[model samples]
Every structure is written in structure tokens, then in C-alpha cells.
Target: MVEADASWRDESLGARVRVALWLRDEVGEGGVFSKASMREAIKGTEQVDRRMRDLRPAGWAILTYRDKPSLQPDQLYLEKIGLPVWRAEHRAAGLRQISAKTRRYVYERDGHMCRRCGISAAEQYADEPGTHARLTLGHVNPHISGGGANAEDLITECARCNETVKHLTGVQMTKEQVWDRMKELPVQGKRQLLAWVKTDFRPLSPAEKVWGMYRQLPAAVREGLEDDLEALMRS
Candidate 1:
């Protein structure tokens, strides 16, 4: 009976909850461990990497080699563990299952572009050159508790920006710095800025909305449509 009762201490819990427990019990904070060790500890679970990534929005601060160059490629460091997903109260933390309908609505509402950086699906960032953006829904406030699956609570975010916002290195431009740049804008630019700020979102123009949808087409279809649009414009 005691053996069977200890399931929460092991696999009877959700994979993510067990993963959090295993990390807390085994690794502690600021400890480094390899993927092999984690998989061994949490055997029979698929997408262990994904479950680990899911913990981040709950404010767990796991770091990779990308975040900390001292670590090996296959290694991950547990900087801080956030929610105790093993507990009943917090099990739902960071695990909002966004429905397909709501997902589509949020994407369309945001013009199918990442709200954080305005990068459309599969478009390369101007600064990052050659790296393409992959769009995903992110919480309006990722670090907050109970970030639900509701459309109003989510924003379209590219994978890159989503990860950056989760980590939040705390060294971005200050408000004064941004305001100084905003002050440089002309009257029309200032008006456009006011519209976005007032609505707390960037409203897509009709042409831009069409472009956002057009960008989602397959490469060959997009190329053909590009030609078709050009020809129709000339006629």
C-alpha cells in the first residue's frame, strides 16, 4: 500500500509535474545535469525536452548553453525552480492548452505576425539576418500566475522573442531611451504611435492583413501569387 501510495513521488503525476519534482529532489538549484540523466530519471515519458521548456513560463529559470556559454550543448542548468507543479494547486501552472479555434482567432487578430517584434511567419529578422521567425502564442504576461488559454490573454510571438521574454535578462532599453526615440517621429508617425499605444496593439492595415495571410501560403503558391498580383496591378 505504501509503495502504491507513493505514485505522486514518481510517475503517477503528470510528466511535467514529475519532471519538476525530480529536478527539485535531485538537482536542487544552480546544479548542472545532462539530458541523459533527466531522461533516465523520468523514463517512459515522451517530449521531455518540451515538458522542461513548459516550466519556464511558470518562472522556472533553467539555462542552456545559449544562455550560459559555460555549459555543454547537451547539458542544462537549473538556475531556479518556480512553481511546485507536483502540488495539486499549482499543477495547472504554465500548462494552458490553447484550443485550435482560439489559437486561430488570436493569430488572425494579431495579423499572423508576432506582436513582440512584428516578425511575420517565416520572415527573417532584419537584425539577425538569415534566421527565420516561427510564430507561436505567448501570454500577455508570461511570468504571471494563471496565464490562461483565453484569446484575450495571449499574444502572437515568434519563438525567438517568446524565449527572450521568458528569460528577461533585464537590460533592455529604458523608458526614457525609448521615449527619446519616439520624440523624433513626425506628426503622422506620432499619430500612428498614439493609435497603437491607445489600443495596446498595432492595428494592421487592410493590405498588411492580406500580406500576412499571403505569407502563410506554400513557397510555390506564394511565388505564383506574387506574379499574379504584379500582372493584375499592371493591367
Candidate 2:
């Protein structure tokens, strides 16, 4: 157990604060730690793992197995520390709670798809076809000095794009590769593609809107509707 005066030992502190303290004092930078051990020390803290992740926005670099290949599934490595949230002034740092209204507005504005990749909620990626993308809200100008929590400041994104942008990852495709595909488009298709590039968003057609909504229906219902549509077309 941590000493009584330790910030991590104080039950009165917020779970996020205590988790940060635990990592700083117990784990240290570039140290390996296990979730089970951290949980045992924090005691009764709901979603301790989430609390640790919450520290990231404040500059913490806690790495899970997903981020580091050498680590065991249950192990995490503390790469870097950010804010000292134990101090009162830094307590709410990087913890911007977007309003429910703002979240809905951003998602609705972006047509419920990732603005970066054009993948709708729960849609599979073209490269990793088996894995479905999870949608989330990302800041339109995340790296800006004064980004805010408003509709204009946010955009809908797949969680993958959000992480990639934050990390400034490599491009998904090369220019030549993409240019070849562009050249393959027919004249009308080229015109349509140029419009999307100019606006930087793909507007869904009315039929596409219906198709997206219809995809959420149960298999039985979808099959029944397909039959109805086929019959109607036959008539």
C-alpha cells in the first residue's frame, strides 16, 4: 500500500486523480504495471482502466498491449506523464465534457459517418474488412491552441481516424495509387469526385440515406423488405 500522505492513498481524491498519482509514484516513467495491481491499490474505483486513459488528454502516455506489442495483454507501460492533476489548478485539465446536445448536433451534421474515412457507424473498413469501425466525435481543429466544445469545432469520426490524427500517422494511401484510381473514373464520375474533393465531404443521396437506415434492421425484416422492393420493381 502507498503511504498515508501519498496522493494515490487518499480515497477523497477523484478516481482519475488517484490513478494518475498511482502511475506517477508507483509506476514511474517507462515502467511496466498490471491492471490487476492498480485496481487492487485503487480499491472500488469503477473503470480504473478508463480513468487511466482519461489521463491521456492531459499528456499521459500509458501504453496498453494494443499500443505496444511486447507487453502482455493485462500489462501496461507508462511511457510519459503529463499534468499533475493532484494539484487543484490542474484537476480539470484536458477533461472537457461535451454537452449531449453538442454531441448529437455534430454526429447529425456529419451524417452519422466518419468525416475522414466516410465509414458509417459500425461499418467495416475496406482494408480490414472483418473489423467494424466505431464512430466517435473528434475535434475539427484538435491541435489548435484554443479548440472548443461547439458544433463547428467538432466532427464525427471513426475512433481509428481520431487516434491517427492525434498521432499524426502516415497516409492511408499514396498519391500515385490514388491518382491511378482517379484516372480510371469516367468523365461524369470524375466530375462528381472533384465536387466531393472541393467540399471535403461526401453528401449522401436520398437512396443512400434510406439504405443506411435500412441496414440497421434485423435480417428477417431486411429480407422481407427486399422481397417487397423486388416485387414493386417487377410491377
Candidate 3:
């Protein structure tokens, strides 16, 4: 039995714990609730829905409209609760630990850029000017039973793409919208994109690979390199 003091009202609890408690206390099993209501109840909890979704890996059966056609778009059904993450023993449940060696190897292998969107570390999104892309490791095949921490099993991805792909929600652009942009590409560009699509991987050009390395240099060194490159070009 859960303790009486394990209340969702306690602001001190981690957001994940509070979300679990809120579902346990407020919305019992087989209950349906809206994202808005949960967000309202758990004010100040950043990405409350994401915290709730995090429970899924722990065997929490949270059914979204995509999973259950009968549910309204904004509604979610708690089919069953899995682990009691609030408990000390199960606190780290469902979280995978990647070794430092594996992390470094994967990032370097992928050219320190997100394999999904081809965005490098600290590069801002074209659509969202002020927001910079953050890189993270994601499973190459997320639907598989066990997503191991091996280098082959992992791929560098921007944080936005990581969440979106894991959730099976397509990127913000519609297929038609993307196709329209693709149609505008020159013939050579189209051929290059087609090759990338066929392989499901974008091969960085020599210049792009060098640019990724350049982006990692210190500010002073980078400025000096810029001047050297310009002088060499003029010679």
C-alpha cells in the first residue's frame, strides 16, 4: 500500500513522482483525463505531459488518442500503472544508463551532429531562430524489445527529434509540405536527397565534416583560422 503522505500536492516531489501520484490518487485505473487538466493541477511542473509519458517505459499504460481511436485528441487513458517510481528500490526503473565510452564513440562517429536532422551541437533550428538544437542519443530502432547501449544500437539525434520520433509523432512539417520544399531543389540537390532517402542516412560532405570540426574549436582559435583561410584563398 502507498503511504498516505505520498501526496501529489507536495511540490517538493520530483515531477515524475508527482505525475504518478496524481494519476494514482486523482485518476484511477481505466480513468480518462485531459492534458489541460493535469497541467492545471500540476502547475509549475515543466513538461508535465512529458513526465507522464516517461512513466510508459516503467510499464505505465498511458493511452493517447493515437493508441485509442475512441479517445478525444486531448484525452489520455490510464490503462494501468507499472512501477512505483516514488519508492527508493524502483526509483531508477526503466531508465537506461549509457557508458561514457560508448557515448563519446557514438558522438565522434556521427560527426557530433544529429543524424536525424543533421544539426550540429549548439546550432539553432532554421524554423526556431532563438532556440538552439541539443543533441542526444536515441535507439536506432526504438520499437525493438530491448534498446541496448551499444554503439550500433544508438544514433545521435537532436532532442526535439528524439522525443518526436520516440512518440511516433511525425516532425512538425507535413509530408506534402516537405515534398513542396523538395520540389524546389535543383536536379543535383534532388539526386543527393534521393540517395539520402534510399539509405535512410545522410552522408555529410567533406566540407560539412570539416565545418563540424571547425565548430568545435575555441572562439579565439576559430577567428584566427577564419583569417588564415581567407588569406590562403587570396594567394
Candidate 4:
């Protein structure tokens, strides 16, 4: 993945070409171009949006809010041109999806620290407030395990804590067992784990895990699970 703010350029024609070259290098021919995907690839939303706009009618790309790629070039062109420049500017200005907002909110709610390993956002953001940080927004209950995307279902954790929890609890424990083990963790760890009780955290096993936990539910319940989780994960 490209590092955030990899470069700073004056948003000019030459700058746009350079950005396109960077995209060509990073994404290659098979890669699909979209606002979100390019934002991720280039690591600068403003840069990507500006480059896209400046190159418009020439190098057009399209993506759904869900991040899915659109194959129709005409639709892509239409959508890109239809959007107001200011809206794209706002998106490039750091206004992220609902999920990103939720993730940051969860991190702040947890005192801007990793509840599992005790890593703080202060330490992660020491050099730059918005720079990449060691702390991650972890799902207290993973989506694969039937977790929702609600504030009550997530927490801030260091990479270590997030990975450890996933590895330790993913397939080895039952939902109840996972809860039991959570009680034995540190205070922060417990705080992280407790966030999942209100949401479903099904274990990864039989296909029923997905079908039953998600599909078989009532429409409202299923919609809640689906929509909320999507919002939280920014998926």
C-alpha cells in the first residue's frame, strides 16, 4: 500500500501527469480506477481527485460508494463529470466515509489508545496528528464472525493486539468461550472485548455462520447487521 501523503505537488498539468504515472506504476493495466481505489493507491485523496478531474474525458474511472468498480466507461465518464468539483474537493479534503469516521470515533472513544496493548494515539501521532499511526481500529467482533459496524462493536487496538485477538479467538473459541477468555485479559483488553456483547460475533466455521447469523435473520435485523457493519468497516 502507498504511504499517506507520499508526495506534495502543486496540482498542475505536469503534476497531474506525474500522479497518473504513479498510478500506472502502482496499479498496472489490470487495475480498475475509482475514486476510493485511487485514494488508497496514491495515498492522497486531493491529489487523486485533482488528477482525475484534470485528465477527464481522457482517463476516466468509476467506483460505487461501496468501492466496487464500474466496467462501463461511459457511465464512469458521466459520473465523474456530473459530480461538482467542490464535492470532490471536499472528499479530497479529508472527509472520509462513514466507516472511517466511525473508526476514528471509536479510537477517540477509547481514549485514543489501543485497548489491548496500551498503545496510545498520542504516541502514534507524535510526529504528525494525521500521519499513519500504530493504533488500528479493530472490530471487537469481526465481520466474518457476524459482527456489526456499530460503535458498540469496535475498539482501538495496536496491530499486535488486533492480530493476536483474531488469531487466538477466530476459530478456536466459541462465542461464549471467547467471552470467557475476554474476562482474563487486561483492563484495556477487557474494554475492547466487552464492546462486542451487544453485537453478534460468530465464530468462523460451518457456512451456517454466515447464512444463519446474517441471511436467516429478519429483514430489519439483517439490514442492521449489513448496513451498520459496512459503515463501521468502511467496506
**Which of the numbered candidates is closest to the native, going by highest TM-score?**
1
User: Which residue pairs of candidate 2 clash?
Assistant: none
Clashes of 2: 0
Candidate 1, position 108, lDDT: 92
CA deviation > 4 Å runs, candidate 1: 1-22, 33-49, 57-93, 169-171
lDDT tens digits by residue: candidate 2, 89-166? 778877767999998778777777788877777677899978887788888765453357888789888988886665
**Roughly what TM-score does model 2 have, to 2 decimal places?**
0.68
TM-scores for all candidates: the values are 0.75, 0.68, 0.68, 0.28
* lDDT by residue for model 1 (45-149), tens: 998866887888677889877778899988889999897766667667777898999999998998988888888888888989988888888998776755778
Report how far residue 188 has shifted in candidate 2, in Å: 3.2
Candidate 4: C-alpha lDDT: 0.48
What TM value does model 3 have? 0.68
How many pairs of residues collide in each model?
0, 0, 0, 2
- Give residue 22's error in model 4 in angstroms: 25
Least lDDT summed over 10 consecutive residues: which range in candidate 1?
A: 1-10
Alpha-carbon lDDT, every model: 0.82, 0.79, 0.82, 0.48
Angstrom error at residue 56, model 2: 3.7
**Cα displacement (Å) at residue 96, model 4:** 15
Using TM-score as the yardstick, the better of models 3 and 4 is 3
